[model samples]
Target: MARDPYRLIGRIQQVAHSLRKKSDHLLIDSAGVTTAQAGILSVIAGDPGCSQRDIARRLRLGESAVVAAIGRLRGAGLVERRVSDQDPRAVALFLTARGRETIGRAQETYGVLNGLVLDALGVGGRARFAELLDALDSAVASFPDRPDEAGPPGPD
Candidate 1:
């Protein structure tokens, strides 16, 4: 996008930062929802009786993070928590009518933002981009913490 990445200038981290900033700002302005809230809402919309622990595992967030976000969503009247029928100690999450409406708005906004990427990448390019991204994700997942990663390139 800005010449090949070298260290910090053209790296994907910069692109991700810019994209997140703009998208987050736009969602906050137009949808009355943050990205995190929208994601949580979507999860609940998909699974009407999911627990907060389920959300934490699915979103790969800490339990505390899910708890805090759910607190805010509850305060906003977007989500309601009820005692689980299967486990009295656990709470199940459900989206309120307002949460569903906000999630719909957020989806519309995301499609609008994704439209820009589609136009830039074209249809075929987007497919290749997704494939490449998945490869990168798989490769980087469970990366070792030591500096031994500085080895020669492997077969790609």
Candidate 2:
């Protein structure tokens, strides 16, 4: 069968959008947080003193995007920022009592979505999908360094 990259890309986009909408409904309703906020909070829950840079790296998000998310989360009273005693210039993130409770409310979304993936893909397929995703990540990471192939499309 001929491979169509666009099909794969579109499928990924659709699945991501669907998952976001479903999770957003439950999370925003219960915790007053979106999936993005829950994700940032999860990182903080796992690593209490992590910096925004750490969250950005872990989430594969740009630093500026993480900063904005953090700002919103801070404003919502869901997260706290403290000047790191170890590094005066760096700010560390920690979840507040409210943040912890909020994440607790949203944790079910992760488990439910993960279970859906497992059921849809099966264990073997899940492993293969992980390998495929890692390969794609490597390809994308080096793509900018590679020379363009045939340049941009021209009039047919």
Candidate 3:
């Protein structure tokens, strides 16, 4: 019989909460960015000039939610938008210098949180978990489409 995949899915939410809590604690004491903002910045940092639609797709976020995030980031001078050269109708997003600095700090906080999670798992456990996750990911990719996401998760 197949194991309950929902348990793994449910555990992921718990892990997300733990990471968010740790990120919040670090930001309050060491930095000044929220975890959600950090995630947005991280995605922007990786793919500069990506559209808000791309970000929403990458993050599995709603369009309105991504727009709100972009607004906050723009207000903070952490992100900037430019009209696409090829298509005047589209806007591309990039991180400002301040945004890069924030992302740097966020990376540190992320490293700490990652260390906590991986350390708890140990090296062997981490390897096995990664292998299982990869296999599951491959299995899911065989499907025609992931109706839940805007598009397939892609090579994340």
Candidate 4:
């Protein structure tokens, strides 16, 4: 018998929601930031001088959402924006000293969460699970109506 695909989708959503809730709590307690904010910070931390468009694209978020997050981060002195050298019309994002510190704490929190997930999956299972997730993502990307259909999904 064919398995119900919707059941798998629902399970995926449930697991994601649970993990997001836990991550939000850990992030709030560790860095006084929301998971969304932490995600933007982490991306900026990894790619200094990246544009807001870059962040939005990489995070699969809307431009306005990324703009708002950047506004909050700037207000909190966790992020700084500078004129982009590549595009004068665009702005580049950088993590401030405090932002780096906050990101360090956020990384620790994520590490704990990662450990929990890996422990649950076991060492060998972790690798296989990651492969499965990648395959799923690729399959979804292959759908004809996908917005960004230029090519297949790249490695995470």
**Predicted structure with the largest lDDT when compared to the true one:** 4
User: What does candidate 4's lDDT look like per residue over 58-91, in tens digits?
Assistant: 9989999999999999999999999988889888
Please provide, for model 3 over 1-156, each residue's C-alpha lDDT reduced to its tens digit, 9 standing for 90 to 100. Answer: 986887987787887788778778886565467877787888999999889898888887898999998998899999999997768999989999999988998898788877987999898899998898899779876877536757667785
lDDT of each: 0.88, 0.89, 0.85, 0.93
Q: List where candidate 4 sits over 4 angstroms from the true fold.
A: 1-5, 146-156
Query: Using alpha carbons, what is the TM-score of model 1?
Result: 0.84
- Candidate 1: list runs displaced more than 4 Å: 1-10, 145-156
Pitting candidate 1 against candidate 3, the one with the higher TM-score is 1
Poorest stretch of ten by lDDT in candidate 3:
143-152
TM-score per prediction, in order, is: 0.84, 0.82, 0.75, 0.86
lDDT of 2: 0.89
The parts of candidate 2 lying over 4 Å away from their true place are 1-6, 145-156
Q: Cα miss at 129, model 1 (Å)?
A: 0.3
Tens-digit per-residue lDDT, 29-110, candidate 1 = 9888888888888899999889988998888788899999999999999999999889899889999999898989999998
Candidate 3 local lDDT, residue 1: 93
Index of the highest-TM-score prediction = 4
Q: Candidate 4, 106: how far from true, in Å? A: 0.3
What lDDT score is found at residue 94 in candidate 3? 94
Report the C-alpha displacement of residue 83, candidate 2, in angstroms.
Answer: 1.4
Candidate 2 lDDT by residue in tens digits, 1-156 = 886876987888888899889989877888789888899999999999899999999998899999999999999998999998789998999999999998988897677778988899997899999899899889888778656788888999
